[model samples]
Target: MSTSTRAGSAAPSIALNFDSIAAARAIVPRLAAISERSEQLRRLDDEAASLLRGSGLARVITPRAFAGLEMSPSAHIRACAEVAHGCAAASWVLMVCVAHDYVIGRFPEACQKEVYEGDADNLIAGALAPQGTLERTPEGWRLNGRWQFGSGCDHSPWLLMGARVANPEAGGYLTYHVVVRQSDMEIDDTWRTLGMRGTGSKDLVARNVLVPDHRAVPTYPTFIGQSPHATAPTYRLPVFAGLPCMLSGSVLGMAEAGLEAFIGHTKSRRDVTGASKSANANMQQRVAESSAEIAAARRLLESACDRFDVAWRR
Candidate 1:
């Protein structure tokens, strides 16, 4: 069953059945095993990328027509959290890749088909900062700029890069976005980060690449819920509004992992004075405080997801 479809397209009658969080959790062992290698490479290893793609977690926001999950935002957050429990870098990359699928759904139908057809598992990486300079051309827009923080670009075949277009009528520039094939661009290995090193969020450079008109989109419509092409309810939500929830899942997951590690260490740890850390009053208090904080963070994330789901559904 193909799961790729265009924006404003109708959802399939039968829901695509899959446990997104379960799928995420099942991959934790492999992700954990490769954490050190991923960190060392400053990017996700090819094995880890293949594992994530094969797991179907990468298609959480892809249209059902393209054999994607088309999952809700809340579900996506939950799934991301589960993935982060194994590896933060992997989870961060997943969040960007999956979210880009949703962003592409807001573009023109031709652009959607160009990326999703013949490749149901196709991944898209994106950089939303308006750093590109767009020039009008006979066929379409000519984009020439360098986009940074192109997360998961190492594994992507396409990219949605943000740019600024000179508006003759308005006397200034308008925010524009273009979708381009990765083959048409150059990748610079500049992703050196203290955290999320495995995401491979390097810089992508495009020089005078002509993006077809069908592949270009303005950011205003999507940001203000005014996209005439976006008929799906998911596309109607404000773009910036849901990003916080997407990022919070990883934070919560990391907190959970830290708490677990601390407790495990405390179980068999000795203080400077040769006392058992887990048995000491101060150590016990710290552990209790950390556990409480993690629990509180989980509740906040759940509440945020609940609110987003309710608003999007309505």
Candidate 2:
């Protein structure tokens, strides 16, 4: 809900200008500077949120029609990993929010347009687990429920909440993501945890919120890469396969950071015997092993992404 009416995707994104990984790297310093502040605030601070929006990293998986870069899976992974180098909480927020945009792409064109009316980089907060009910109505659907883990909701104006809809024809319930303005639901500040506090994974309560038919998207089709609005191969990559790759980037980044910290600590660390860890053969071996393992993980995750990219292209 970017109400200011400034709409334009970055100019004809060429390879170098639209490199998501580089954009993430540019914001790394700022993200690190505010890491402690974000933790203390129990959510991403204003500056960090601004940095994420300006960096354009969240648009990697967004649709091209809405000024999204629509980059490949590998690119998304690399960008998240880069952000994780500075702060894992920020990385998780970036990754989850980007995926939310991708999900928006799955909605009908009308809904996508309505959601992105103000700007293309509009952020969407989501709670994946289905815990609500949608009752049929003349105007649209009435959504009611209490959902948890609404990550990144502090910054997003739009929210995609999962709910169950009754199917009269099939006599069963189907899962749907009801798109609603963030203000439509009451946000509860219940996210308190020992780690990753900056994610702001709060709880949301919705009481008879009206969701238009176009904005309610099915879960199964999107899961199987069959978006009504998104016809491109990128959106076609079933989330069951693609989401794991997209979310894996943060873990990979955390592992890389852990490796870097170990290397830095050992460089000047002395053992109990007063022997320099850097000079000790066993410590050196451990360092090499950790470095190799991290590298291998990066390669493995990227490789999986690359394969998905290739399949989607065909």
Candidate 3:
């Protein structure tokens, strides 16, 4: 467990000077150039990762008081979608990092200061499924297990993992979470997939690591918009429900990218009968249908995100 070095220090209340969506757009070209390289390496390229960090898109959901933009849900979705247009893997990592920042905000103020006080841009990797076993102790909880699908763990300094904790009073186990430094865990290079291979969804193993009480957070409260800063609209929203929405943007963007590629290839394709695809009625119908589907899906996802934005503001 890593503690804050600045003794008796308060969390910084500085504001960031960057637009989340615009920063994402600026990095699109770099991500696009390295999309294939990322897939081959089974993680994000170094250059692309540097560009993304410099762009300041990873802190979109970080609290503004910590020098983060803390953009709205809809804006965050748009930023992910924009980055996904260049590379789905890059966008996946970006979403994972940003989402973890939001999760960090749900913890106690002391936990927030420990993470953000030293480095505002500290990326956090997370595995949502409760895979670890937790036992209560005087200091805190003892965690030992392996978490899978640790997406974007390559660049994160902290890891947010889920575990099943014993309930002495209730005689049943409940899911809980603890934040730990990346150095406390071991990464297993077991992520090999067909699509989205660049996500680096590796396995993180922790053996008998002790997490302090202040670093622990309950599950139910976080899901129901309970936070230290509950008065703020962003923290008040049902933050967990927004996870699927956060991921939907990348799916839509990837589908759109695939559709565009198919259309471009079709224009130069020739049928067995020696007719160019651009001149073939059947190919034209297929392209039109695919384009319509992509457009409609985009509209639906964007509409849902718009509704989320409305709810956040209210």
Task: Please report the candidate that would top TM-score against the real structure.
Answer: 1
lDDT of 1 by residue, 16-116 (tens): 36677889999999999988888999888888888788888877777655566555677778888988888988888888877777777777767877888
Q: Write the residue-wise lDDT of candidate 3 on 120-187 in tens digits.
A: 77768878788987888888888899989898898888899888886634313377778988888999
Q: Which stretches of candidate 3 lie over 4 Å from their true place?
A: 1-18, 168-173, 229-231
Question: What is the Å distance of residue 190 in model 2 from its true position?
Answer: 1.3
Model 1 stretches with alpha carbons more than 4 Å out: 1-16, 168-173
For residue 284, model 2's alpha carbon misses the true position, in angstroms, by 3.9
Each candidate's lDDT (Cα)?
A: 0.79, 0.79, 0.76
Off by over 4 Å in 2: 1-17, 166-173, 280-282
- Select the stronger candidate by TM-score from 1 and 2: 1
Write model 2 residue lDDT over 230-295, tens digit each, in one string.
Answer: 665566677777668778889999889878888888788888999888999888888889889888
| Per-model TM-score on C-alpha atoms | 0.91, 0.89, 0.89
Error of 3 at 121 (Å): 2.3
